[model samples]
Target: MLYKLNLEHILFLDIETVPESETFEQLDDVKQELWEHKTQYQRKDEFTAEEFYERAGIWAEFGKIICISVGYFTSKGDVRNFRVTTFHGAEAKLLKEFKNLLNSHFSKPNHLLCAHNGKEFDFPYIARRMVIHGINLPYKLDLFGKKPWEVPHLDTMELWKFGDYKHYTSLKLMANVLGIPSPKEDIDGSMVRDVYYNNGDLDRIIKYCELDVITTAQVFLRLRNEELLSDNEIVRI
Candidate 1:
């Protein structure tokens, strides 16, 4: 018998990244040196990893974590149930803990991980960082290795292709178009590094991550209702 997808098996996640701060200036120096060394792709204002680290801040600096947030949705019938979890801490430790949590709490091996543009950014970022921290990735994230339609993935941006991929759209824009209330407000991905660096407010970063997860969930619902759902009903988890 063919198995049906269960509501409990869907996980929606998001992440925020920033450059390291302590080595900020040192990074800039390295960038300048490298730019001087490389003739091609070099310019008067061109920056190296070191320079960018100094100017833009490295992802490892500014407390390490940046932010990681996840959303879980369980659908029953006309209402969708939602729960969110967020983590903020040193980059290495937080990522390790996040991996551990995934392994211990949600390691069913059958769960579907969902995110907007996740295949391109969020998922790969997490995997690469986890490997850097000496942690094993809990699941396979190599979408490129799978057949175009066979990959067990969903990107809201991809769904918009039904409309001819008309204009590029963001999660925030999609939520607005679908009448879904976005919790992002004034905070956005671009402001994440500054918010964590300048204000040192981890709470805001956590909230910001939560908002992205929630927005992603909303987008998932919109797509399900329009194309996947057999009826106009949301099942509460």
Candidate 2:
């Protein structure tokens, strides 16, 4: 099925998010209460809400995307290049830029958005954040009333599952087992919040996110039984 689709028609992406504020105390009393209630099941008396705030970035309501790195393939004859770019800075501003990119470039019915665990995480998180910012949903991101088959989104994690809904796979695990290079170097998802909030290193986060995008595109190619991209084939802009 993957071989049937043109690689250029799919936009591969990864996002880095952090809690909206630096600390739990930054959230007002109402939000603090909601946070505690929202995470009760996940926390399960193991940690207080304040202690668990480090993970707030996983939830769109409590988090904001700091970077969105996207990559896409452009093939010329036998040669293929994967070009990646990142949108960073303020959440609303970056989201608007991302929405514009989707609306202008990837609005075609055949153009799909691809990500690892996207359906479960990245895709919905982007949509939810866009709505929160009052940004109109681009055609690619808006899924309202669309039949499952009509949704123009692809998830590598879902593809890896292949039918076992009970199974879950992290991107690193998938890359490792597939012999694709690991994207992680200085930090991982667990450290993104601190990297952004404490270290004040947006560039580092952007680099990490872009690497994930490249890795995701590589994983997709591997799944399609295609050749992996070489270092020279990856161009970041």
Candidate 3:
């Protein structure tokens, strides 16, 4: 089934998120209590709510998307280019822009959205945040009543699983195993919050997010047994 799909019809994406507040104390009393209750099972006496707050970005209700980098394939006359673009800044503003892109270009029924662990993380997180901001769901992100196979989304991690429901793999690990080039040395998801709040380095974070998008595309190609993308084929738009 994978071999039958056209790469041009797919949009590869990755997102970076940070806690709504710089610190747990910065949250209002009500939110503070809610956070504690929300994370009780995950915290389990190992870490306090404040200590676990850094990971709040993993939950859309407690986080805001800072950057969304997307790449799509374009080919003409045997020449192929992977065009990459990013939407960043205010959460609501960026999400609106992203929604426009989805509605305008990838709105077709044949189009698909792909990411690593997207179904579990990226896809639902974007939809939840959009709902919180009162933004209407885009065609691809809105999965209200669609059947399982009718969903126009792809997940590299799920493809790798191939029926091994208990198996899990990180993007970095999958990229390494697939021999896809990865430059994830600087900072990982764990440091994104600190880098954003403490360093105020949105540029660095955007680069990291864009790289993940590129790596995701490459990993998909590897899964399909296609040649990896060359540096010259990637265009940052």
Q: Highest lDDT among the candidates is held by which one?
A: 3
TM-score of each predicted structure versus truth: 0.73, 0.98, 0.98
Give lDDT tens digits, candidate 3, residues 69-144.
9999999999999999999999999999999999999999999999999999999999999999999999899888
Give the residue spans of candidate 2 off by over 4 A: none
Where does candidate 3 have its weakest 10-residue lDDT segment? 180-189
TM-score of 1: 0.73
User: Which digits, one per residue and each the tens of the lDDT, describe model 1 over residues 1-237?
Assistant: 012556567778888777555454544565545434542343346755444443332223222446688877556676656777876677777887777767776666566677887766677777777766777666545454567555555566766766674556788888888888656366877777777777877788777777777778777766666332222232322
In candidate 3, stretches whose alpha carbon ends up further than 4 angstroms from where it belongs are: none
* Arranged by TM-score, best first: 3, 2, 1
lDDT of 3: 0.95
Q: What is the C-alpha lDDT of each candidate?
A: 0.64, 0.93, 0.95
lDDT of 1 at 216: 81
lDDT of 2 by residue, 41-76 (tens): 999989999999999999999999999999999989
lDDT at residue 105 of model 3 (Cα atoms): 93
